[model samples]
Target: MLKRIILILLVFSSSMAFSQNGENTWNTLSKVEIEKRFDETLNFEVDYPTFSEEVKKLNGKTIELKGWMIPLEELQGETYFVLSSLPFANCFFCGGAGPETVAEVFSKGKYRFTEKRITVRGKLEINAEDPMKLMYILHDAEIVD
Candidate 1:
């Protein structure tokens, strides 16, 4: 019937729309490729990232990512920390993983350190200019279930 065909088309269209919006994932963020370039100001070579079109599109957009928390300071009431795609022993700082595997997270709420993987939502910023910071920065982040 005509009504059945129309309903099927409507459902298909809605599912297509949902699929297009579901691209915010860690794999999409890992599309960035970096090359070491000499910085005249710092007088040293630093890794500079070249973000792919997919990763570039995520800049300034609120995205959700799941990662293990890397506490910078003490275990209690930490407002800022690093989130790594890998666990503690295999993280960027300790293991051989690249900078793309980590993100600097800045949150207003204090969080207790946990070894478990945590999901966070925030606006992602790609830091190409600041050598002192990580290549990926998450601003106004909050831990989510």
Candidate 2:
């Protein structure tokens, strides 16, 4: 009975760890190389990010991210917004961080703007060729916390 109980506990712990795979996804996504590339349409050089192999492996996979909501249009209950590693005051647009510090979140439902940190889960899509779009985009995202 003691051995059986121990085995069950070990199995449960392992499963729990696996279920939290996205807990530190932001750290892995940070592994990127940025370079300036000239865009013919824009007539100027734009910063382009090349995702690392570790980051590419996460593409098309469901992951979770924790960050602050950034409203672009000052609209309430937005279905899409930017998620930043830092708060609005220290975010990328604020000139305190880089583009990689933020991800475009396209949620399934409208999310009210808040100063609190929130967690979201969705399938991550990497955009390397589009200069107009963010480097990281979370599709079908929903608030987890």
Query: All predictions: root-mean-square deviation over Cα?
Result: 9.3, 8.7
Kindly give the stretch of ten consecutive residues in candidate 2 with the minimal lDDT sum.
13-22
Going through the candidates in order, what is the number of backbone clashes in each?
Answer: 0, 0
In candidate 2, which residue ranges exceed 4 Å CA deviation? 1-19
Name the Cα RMSD for model 2.
8.7
lDDT per model vs. reference: 0.79, 0.81
Give the TM-scores of the predictions, in the order they appear.
0.79, 0.81
Candidate 1 local Cα displacement, residue 59, angstroms: 0.4
| Cα distance off (Å), candidate 1, residue 135 | 1.1
Please give the TM-score that candidate 2 achieves against the real structure.
Answer: 0.81
Off by over 4 Å in 1: 1-24, 74-76
